[model samples]
Target: MNDFDALQAVIRRLAAERQAEQRACEAFLNALYHALRTASGPGLPLNNVTFDFTPDPAERLRPPPPGGWHAAWLRLGLCEVLVRVRRDEGAFVGEYGEGGTFHLTGVTEDDLILLARRLLRDVAAAYGGGGLVGRSGMPLN
Candidate 1:
């Protein structure tokens, strides 16, 4: 094959690999979003919860690292949570409000769901109570 043909082949292969990685990331995020939403109970202060794809500087698309392209942001209330899924190493790393961080090795979806639940519960307890005041200096509940 000529040089041009060789380059075209390489580009096609890279595109396919990137697409696969994107699909995997989407699947993981979907499962996680469902877990979080289910865990949020009635009267919970958590609102505007959103998840989006975020790429880490240390990550690459092809030959995915131990912690691959599965990085996402989970935003709720006044907090932004980082969720990094490391499928190759069977682990996950999370960083969030107030310097709180957790690294779970040999992790499972259940573990992640539990962590998210706990974090939201804590935030509600701390900020959603009536002890605090809103911008107008009125009681907040």
Candidate 2:
């Protein structure tokens, strides 16, 4: 094969790999969403959560590089948290934090899910003992 042809082949292979990884990440995000909704454990399941794959408003001021930061906000009642995932050196790296203070790096979907559950439990412990209020200010059962 000519040099150009070899380069093209390499590019195609890399593209395919990137596409596969993207699909996996998408699947992971969807699974995480469902898991949070149906998650059963120490705290209440986050059935009323909202998720979006957009940059935080502050971060939007500066555009992210290719395959840079991908973030999802999990808004539960009056509580809000951020879940961010990105490709770093060909591996998946993730962070989840309450109120945008990301402090954990999760390498797998399961790890991220576990962190999310812990956040939910912490919120419940903090505000739900007396009564948890929904976004609309209605009491949560």
Candidate 3:
């Protein structure tokens, strides 16, 4: 084919790949949200945490905030953590309060749970230390 046609084919391929990536990101975020929401048990740092999905999962068609295409907010007491899928890296970006930023890579539900647990630990550390407790009165530090 002509050079113009070749470029058009490349553009089409890139567009399709980007769209697939977006879908994958969305699925990943949704699964993560559910995993974190339902997680519970003694000694779990997330017991006192509040989780919220940006644009809500039902509103996926809506545009996302400038921070990321999709986000999960984890709030504990006064500390707030934001988790989002990085468009460029395709990894989960975890940001807590001011300067605590981390990247978590995972693809399965189990991986997401581990990622959430890790985020909670970091958030607890950022919040202060050793004061987080579950309903069972167990220390989570």
Candidates in order have lDDT scores of: 0.59, 0.58, 0.57
- How far is 33's C-alpha from truth in model 1 (Å)? 2.2
Residue ranges of candidate 1 with Cα displaced over 4 Å? 1-11, 41-46, 60-67, 89-112, 118-141
User: Model 3, which residues run further than 4 Å from truth?
Assistant: 1-13, 42-79, 86-106, 129-141
**Candidate 1 residue lDDT tens string, 3-38:** 999976876777765566556556766666666776
Ranking by lDDT: 1, 2, 3
Model 2 regions more than 4 Å off: 1-22, 41-45, 56-67, 89-91, 98-113, 122-141
Count of backbone collisions in candidate 2: 0
Model 2 clash pairs? none
Model 3 score (lDDT): 0.57
> Residue by residue across 1-141, what tens digits does model 2's lDDT show?
999999667666677555665555555555566667756643666668777666644455233434555567767767766666656666555655532222334446566576556557656654646343344555444
Alpha-carbon TM-score of each model against the true structure: 0.50, 0.49, 0.49
Of 1 and 3, the candidate ahead on TM-score is 1
lDDT winner, 1 or 2: 1
List all candidate RMSDs to the true structure.
Answer: 9.2, 9.5, 8.9
Count of clashing residue pairs in every prediction:
0, 0, 0
